[model samples]
Target: MPEPIKVLVTGAAGQIAYSLLYSVAKGDVFGKDQPIILVLLDITPMMEVLKGVVMELQDCALPLVQEMIPTDKIEEAFKDIDAALLVGAMPRRDGMERKDLLAANVKIFQEQGKALDHYAKKTVKVVVVGNPANTNAFICSKFAPSIPKENFSALTRLDQNRAQAQIAGRLNVPNNAVKNCIIWGNHSSTQFPDVSHATVTKNGVVQPVAEAVKDDHWLNNEFIKTVQNRGAAVIKARKLSSAMSAAKAICDHMRDWWFGTHEGEWVSMAVPSDGSYEIEQDLMYSFPVNIKNGKYTIVQGLKIDDNAREKMNVTMKELKEEREMALAACQE
Candidate 1:
């Protein structure tokens, strides 16, 4: 067999990593034929827990993973790795400010980003699954100067999927019928799930974007409010945290990027800006993207109606302000 692909997951001891490492081994993200060399990294104490997880992965005998490594050294763990999953972070407690969370996580991602610049494989694509993930991803990419800015993304696919499922349920069709749903801006509550561009269908007929069969107006303000707040609902229901679904988002984000987007179908991801759709550079805000030839390019020239533009603008503003705050903190 050809050499396995080297994939790295920081914070292998965390709950999201708990689910993600197994999925990677079983070919959930990478293809089954593509064997993976799983490089697991965490703080020193988590190595023991990560080791137990690795032992189970070994027994499963997946064609996807050839080996697993549990390490604490950022430089060594990321060395020449194919893809990096960043799930380890300083999570926000109930009373903490977002800036405080970002400040703490920024320090962690910065060191790793430098290590990635020095040691990660030339083509490593990073997905940040941590809290304040968008800003953390921005900090990580900023530290790694040589890598293509497009190679870094934060997880917003979960919000996208959540919106799609909500629409599908409302329309009484399978989730597959929902297309072109978007989560623009930060992965936090500020995300805007716009279905304005979607073609929702049921049975054999296509319908407009609406919450009800009678009313074709789901891309309206109320639905936008609902989709953006769905994260809080999940937290309330689970009464703990959003780990499993977050892991699923990490899986879906990479899977769609690696596999081509469905023909003419675009999804939401927090790709870096090249001034696409008026988003500034390096802010890590979510945008509508279609993957072609293993690269994600923002879908261009879509008619941005007034509501869409307003939503995009608000999210972009939050990202821009966050970027400024981060730069100031970096100087401190």
Candidate 2:
């Protein structure tokens, strides 16, 4: 048997991890043929909880999970890992400001980024899932100078999933019918869930989203707002942030990233920008991307009409401000 690859999950005791660990162990993210070692890490105070989580995994007797290591030490967690799911970050309190939340997470990601640089494999793939994920991912990539920028990404798959689901519900088609939904810029409220290039298939006939929806006013307004605020809606309904759906989205993200996207389709990932679509350079901005052989290239040359351009600009401005705030936080 080939040696098992090590996959690290930070914030292993959190709610999202609670759901995520199971799917990963069942061979949902990586292929079923590959064996994996699960390295679970959380803060010192969460050690007991993490231990229980680890114990549960052991009880499952999953064949793909060759070994499980639960740790509170960052150095131990990072060492020689093949991939990292960076899910930990300080959460925003009820009365706290956005900058304060960014400052708190900056310290966490910077430390983890340095650990990734010093300990993780050079080819490690990282996807940051914490709150303010785009900015946090940018901070992480900055601290890990040696790792290629393409090695890192922020989780915008959840937003993309939300957008696709909304469009499907509107058109009375299955969610899988929606294709090429693009989420532009940050993971925050300013994100532009664009359907300009999206298409939906119903009864085996593919039609552009605008044509199928046939209500530009609703598509331009309600649809976008619903996707942007879906997180809040989930929170309000459950009295907790999304866990099951978030975990599933994370799995979808890593799975597609490892294997490649299908032909003629693209997904949203917040990766370091190289001025694609005139977005600011080096800011972790979300764009439609296609992956091949474990590398991602931004989908280029799509025409951005006036409405799409305006929406993109709003998200771009927010991401720029976020990058500024995240950099300032790094200095502290």
Candidate 3:
């Protein structure tokens, strides 16, 4: 038998975790034959529900080995893990501004970051799924001075996936053919899904959609709105939060990081900055990326139009503001 890959999933009791844990265990994301050791990390209060999930996994008899661990100590949960899905955070409540929310999440990720520094494997690739994910990733990466900043990223694959699905429906093509769609900037309303570069391949014909739908002004405006606000749309229709798809996004984030990006396509992830496209160094904003050798590399050199550039600059500023605000709080 080969060495088993150890995957640590935080927020194991989350709605997203419900789909995530079972899917990974049943080999839907990772290979069916690949042996895995799953460490489910959650707060101690969630022990009972976590135990129930573990029992279900046991019944499935997956090729993977699963373990349940309810703990508030992130250091203990992440030690020696190959991949850590840093999910679950304090969701915003009424009357809370984005700055307030960012400050709250910074504290949690700060502790987790310190834990990762002290205990996680040197090669650990972390994906932050919590709200304000890019900023949360910033705290973790900055705190873990030993880890390469590039090893840390936030979940934007869901945005990419969502963009692809929406494009497929509008263009009437199978999702497999929609290649190279990119979501740039914060995973919020400010995010830009640049379908301007998308290509749809079907029936032995490859269609360039950036031009095909360029004239559909209504669609151009509506598609962007739909892609950006799809989260709210789901919540409105379902009358609950988005747990299943969010969980799926976490899986996609990890799966691509470990396995591979498509030959000609890359997904979006918020990664530590090297000042690309004038993004401030270390902002942890989302960029198009290709993963290799257990790491993610930003796909630089893509042309950024004025509109795209302006949108990204706004989100970058938002991240920097959040960072500075957090820093000020730390000082106080």
- In candidate 1, which residue pairs get closer than 3 Å at backbone N, Cα or C atoms, i.e. clash? 36-64, 210-218
Candidates 1 and 2: which is better by lDDT? Answer: 2
Candidate 3, superposed: residue stretches over 4 Å from native:
66-72, 92-97, 214-216, 330-332
**Which residue pairs collide, candidate 2?**
none
The candidate that achieves the highest TM-score relative to the unseen native structure: 2
Please report, as a residue range, the 10-residue window in candidate 2 with the lowest summed lDDT: 90-99
lDDT of 1 by residue, 110-134 (tens): 8888888999887998998776888
Total residue pair clashes for candidate 3: 0
Q: Write the per-residue lDDT of candidate 2 for residues 1-332, one digit (tens) a residue.
A: 67889999999999999999999998989988789999999999999999899889999999999999999888999999999999987764444566777877888999999999999999999999988899999989999998998999999999999999999998999999999999999887789999989999998999899999889999888888998988777777877778899899999999999999999999999999999888889989999999999999999999988888888889889888888888887787
Candidate 2's displacement at residue 233, Å, is: 1.8
- In angstroms, give how far residue 308 of model 1 lies from its true place: 1.9
Worst 10 residues of 3 by lDDT: 211-220
* Residue 312 lDDT, candidate 1, scale 0-100: 85
What TM-score does each of the candidates earn? 0.94, 0.98, 0.93
- List the candidate 1 regions with Cα displacement exceeding 4 Å: 211-219
Who is ahead in lDDT, 2 or 3?
2
Candidate closest to the true structure, highest lDDT: 2
User: Which residue runs of candidate 2 sit more than 4 Å off their true CA positions?
Assistant: 93-96
